[model samples]
Target: MTSAEAVPFRFFSLQVVRTRRLGPSLVRITFAGPELRDFRSDGLDQSLSLFLPHPGQDEPMVPIELGEDWWRGWMELPEDVRAVMRSYTLRELRRDADGATTEIDIDFVLHGVEPDAAVPAGPASRWAAQASAGDRVRLIGPSAADNRSIRFRPPEDTDLVLIWADETAVPAASAILESLPPGTRAVAWLEAHHAEEAQKLSVAADADLVWLVSDDGAPAAIDAVRAAQLPDAERPYVWIAGESGRMKELRRHFVNERGVDRRRVTFVGYWRQGLTEEQLREQGE
Candidate 1:
């Protein structure tokens, strides 16, 4: 069946409602806006564009008009003319009692340590760390995928659902689990650099949660997840996200080795090692 065209893009002014540390390295920022009243909730796992103001800049740069043709023109513009655009997951959408206000959350992974830490620093991490309540940010998105679809309601008899991700995708993965049916049985594999970096997630009673820490070496968490055994065949749906290479590897295992139906499994490369968010976008193109 043919898919529907994307919803027209609209710019919205979002205020930072709250911020909290989810784990040692993960920070959650909740934003609310009046424009979100009509926001479509179908794109739970889909990405949105965040136009943040450059340091010291008073206003964020956003396109005056938005549409397919507008996006095409923006893409065709000189490289220098395009503003910095960051990709983030929809995470969760919550509407107020009156439905006039909506809250959307996004998680950012802290990159570096103060004077005594190891990992490198992340740009988004820094921005999130300093953002305060009432701070305004420009949001432009809810872009629909060309032929993407997901089934939230699995068969009643299905025995298991599997989810996996690293820090960058924890927000999206967690949101997905939270929206699942009350009694759905599932297993989640979350990878983190340190034990403390794993967030205490709220999942269904029937779900199994596994946290894997990467103490050393490259892609250690992915290795741990790969080495583990999946649940007994009960037609479980799998979702995996994280480092580009690791996600690609797991996608292969799910599709080629296990023969899972493509439609039942979702895989996303939230980020790649040694590359900035901008670099990842260019690579994706």
Candidate 2:
């Protein structure tokens, strides 16, 4: 909110195209927009902010302006006046050259069945749930660095690709798997709350899929991925994401014990445990 020169971010007005259940815990929402005319074709794992109105509010209140002044006003507003905002990943981006329309897709993980369950259903999810083709929602971000599509090309003679993720990161992990070149050797480990929530992903022919369920409350997926043996290769890349604590642990292990080059590995903390979107931002400060 604190306007630091208004970083020149582009805004998009998106309308929900469709929403479908991906798994027991994940839902996929597709959005189309006109501002996407020149939208960059960034593939999976990209992140953005979906701004929402305050609870019980039906419409978004755009600031007469954005930046420092807006942030100051936001801070001074009553607790209920502050709206909720959530971070989500771009699971897919499709642009129609002829139609001149672009569609962006994202997956949301349903946390629980509580009355507050509606909260994690962020602004985007909320809109996706009730919005029709013409209804609009505001979208901001896809940071400059993250705006581009992530293309992972394993070395021709590499041994294998290692992917580790939890429910929050499954969509990106699945995309990464599907993008690998044919005959690429890869191993993916995904963790979810229930076995029913595990997804059947589209991956390269040589990639092996490993699914782990939290039946006994054990963090088996992370442990399995971390404990696996890696074959020596010229250069291998590792991609890991999920809960903040788990991600941090994997990062330290790869950097210290494994001696893997930091540049060759992409580790991200999709979300932290027990922290709201606002708390997460505040803690970053």
lDDT of each: 0.67, 0.66
- TM-score of each predicted structure versus truth: 0.79, 0.79
TM-score of 2: 0.79
* Worst lDDT 10-window in candidate 2: 142-151
Model 2 stretches astray by more than 4 angstroms: 1-8, 62-64, 67-76, 98-101, 114-135, 142-159, 215-218
* Per-residue accuracy of model 1 over 227-284 as CA lDDT, tens digit each: 7677677477778877888877887777787777776776777667788766776676
lDDT of 2 by residue, 83-146 (tens): 4567776777775757443788877776543355645554444544454455455666432333
Pairs in clash, predicted candidate 1: 111-120
